[model samples]
Every structure is written in structure tokens, then in C-alpha cells.
Target: MIEAISTETTKFRHATVGRTGTALLGIGIALLAAVMPLAAQSGDPRMLDKLGEAGERSWDGLLSGAAQITGAGGLLGFGVVLGWMFGREFVDGTITGLFGLPVSRAQIAAAKLIVYLAWAVLVSALIVGALIVGGLALGLGLPPTDTAGGLARQFALGVMTALVALPVAWVATVGRSVLIGVVGAIGLVIAAQVATIGGAGGWFTVAAPALWALSEGDDVSGLQLALLAPLLILVVGVTLHAWRTLQLNR
Candidate 1:
């Protein structure tokens, strides 16, 4: 079990949080930070006009703007990473070698989740740091208390987004392809948009975090937040089961 755990951990670190992934994450943060000041203006002129009264260049505004960018990226990243982690084993035929290992497949799956969670947290922190630095550089006049609160909220939102994306692992495993998992992730984004546009976003687990991050108001209820627990539990359980009983016959 220890061997399996250590091996999976090392693989995840190399694939997801290694130099290349870290560099990409840094570049994404920098791009988001640079565009935050111009977010309201860089898009459609009509949209900017519509946001005229609400879109001041305040700290909260900047956070929301950055969240809008990072939230989508985070979700996409989660899906892509999970897909790669699981699907690559199948593609390379390494999955067949796990049949009689002393370490169970479930443990390997769990290790992947742990590693991905750690990566997600680190990327989220870097994003928040970049936003703070960028806001300060732009003289956005961020009040300390509000800035602290916003940071906490953003951090929580980022973590929750990663948790919510756990099901993509199962999707990748079942489909045996990363492209399918990416498509699943895209489907999720579309569903979130539809739910949000229909005014039921607060009740939807996937949409709730993004909505919360984009708005300063209390858009989500306690019940809504609580629902995410069961969703995560369900996906994790299903994934472990799938990995344990999987028959890799190529």
C-alpha cells in the first residue's frame, strides 16, 4: 500500500504539478491579473455599458473579475488533470499490471485525488496572490478588511471547485479516454451556465461556487453548501469501486 501510494504520488507530482504545469499555472495567473483591470472594457462595449453602475474598479470587483477567469480555468484544469492521470494508465497499458499488486487500486485512486487536491490548492493560492499583487500595483484601493474577507471567500471557492470536480475522475476511468473527460467537463460548464441563467444556480452544486465567487451577496444557502458533501462522497465512492473492479482487457 505504501509503495502504491508513493508511486502514485510521484506520478501525480510529475504530471500535474511539475515544472511545466507550474509554469503554465503561473502564466495563467499573470494573464488573468493583467486582464483584470481591463475586464470590464476588454469585452463587449454593450456589456461594459450594462455594468456601468456596478463595475467599479474596486477590490471586490477585481476579485470577481479574476474569479470569473480563474474559476473556468480551474474547472477545466481539474477535468484535464483527472483525465490525464487516469486515462494515461489505460493508454500506456500500465493498468493491466495492477491486477496482482499488493497495493489495491482504490488506494491508487485515492492518492491521485489527494495529489490533485494539493495541486488545486496551490494553484488557487498563486492566483489569489497574483490578484492581490496586481490590485496593489494598479492602485485599486483595497480596504484591508474587505480584502481579507474576499481572499478567504476566493480561497474557499477555489477549494470547493476542486472538490466538485472529483467526479471527472470517474468519467475518465469509465470512458478510458481523456477526450471524453474533457467533453464531460465542457458539458458541466454548459450545465452550470444553463442552471445559473435559469435562476436556480443557488441550488445547483456545480454552479453555486462560481455564482458565490462572482457575487458579494449571499447567493447560496446552507443547504446548498451541505449538498456538495453527498455529491463528492457519491463520486468518490463510485470511482473507487470502478477502479477496484475494473477489467483492463486490451
Candidate 2:
């Protein structure tokens, strides 16, 4: 079982980790790191006005700026990557090859989920690290305690947001197209927006984490946090069942 999973994971990495994708992800992070702090300190009314501060550089300000990038990036990136990863199999007509392997379809699907989750976590870490380093270099006058707590919250938010996107795998598989998954991802973002605007975002599993990340107070309850786990489990279960019973001919 371990060997089969390892082999499948390697194959997944090769198919997804292309030069263009790597370069783009790196460049996005670099730009976010460099641009966020500078924009905060730029003294432009347009920039400072949104930050709600008049030339006050602090960790909270920097993180608030960075959150805009991470929040949107984390949500969108998960959908695109998952959709592409699973959808590519159908696009290339290789999904049929997944049958009759030593590994079960469930295991292969599980391995893909695991790998993508790891990748999301790593990317989130890199984004946070860059933000921290950039904030310090810019001499944002924030205490270490506040900086640590804020970064930790941001990291958790990123992970939770990505996890909620796991159901896109099932969407891609069932629809047998990557485009469907991407569209579904966009739909989710729209739904989250609607929920937030309606003042019920905390009850929404998809929007809760991002909202919590940007919140300065205890807007999200423990029940809301706990709800995320079951949502993830439901999606994983549905996706595994879809893969296990999927008919290649259809």
C-alpha cells in the first residue's frame, strides 16, 4: 500500500509541477512580499485610506495588507490546482489507466489529496514567511507577540480555506472536465461573497476561515471552527466514493 501510494504521488508531482507553474507561484509570492509593505508606507491617500491608518506602519497594518493577497490567493489557487490535477487525467485520457493498478482508485485519490494539501500548507508557509520578513525589514513597529499571533492566525486561515476547496476534486472527477472545477471554484467564491454580504459568513464553512483571518476580534466561534472538520470529511468521503466506483467508459 505504501509503495503504491508513493509511486502514484511521484507521478502526480511530475504531471503537475511544471516550469511555468513553479515560476508563476514564485513570482506571485515575491510580488506580494515586496508590494504589500511598500504600499502600506507609500503615503498615497488611496493606499493609506484603505489601510485605515495615516502613515502608521504596524504589524497589523502589514498583515491586513498581506491578507488581501493570501486570502484571495489561497482560495483561488486551491481550486485551480485541484481542478487541473484531476482534470488533466481526463483531459489526457489517462484516467482510464488508473484502473487495474496495484493501488485502488481510492488510494490514488487519497494520495492526490494528501499531496495537494501538503503543497497548500507549504505555499501558505512561504507566503507568511515572506510577509514576516518583509514587515520586519520595513520596520513595522509591532511587538513580537502580536506579529507571531497574527501570522499564526493567517496560516490557519489559509489551510482551512484550502481544505474547504477539496470538494472541487469530486466536481472535476464527476464532470470529467477541468473547466467545470474551475467554474465551480468561481461559483464558490461568489457564494462566499454573497454570504458575507448577507451578514451570515460565520455560518458558512467556505467564508468563515477567511473572515476569521481578517477579523480583529472574536467574530468566529469555536463551533464554526469545529464545523470545518466535518465539512472536509464529507467532501473527502464523497470524492473517494466517486473515484472508487467511477466507470471509465462514461
Alpha-carbon TM-score of each model against the true structure:
0.88, 0.87
Model 1 bad stretches (over 4 Å): 16-30, 39-44, 50-55, 141-143
Cα misplacement distance, residue 130 of candidate 2 (Å)? 1.3
Stretches of candidate 2 exceeding 4 Å from the true structure:
15-30, 40-44, 51-56, 141-143
Candidate 2: deviation at residue 87, Å?
Answer: 1.2
Query: What clash count does candidate 1 reach?
Result: 0
Where does candidate 1 clash, by residue pair? Answer: none
Cα lDDT for residue 124, model 2? 67
Clashing pairs in 2: none
Q: Whose lDDT is greatest here?
A: 1
Please report, as a residue range, the 10-residue window in candidate 1 with the lowest summed lDDT. Answer: 17-26
What's the lDDT for all of these models? 0.74, 0.73
Candidate 2 local lDDT, residue 26: 32
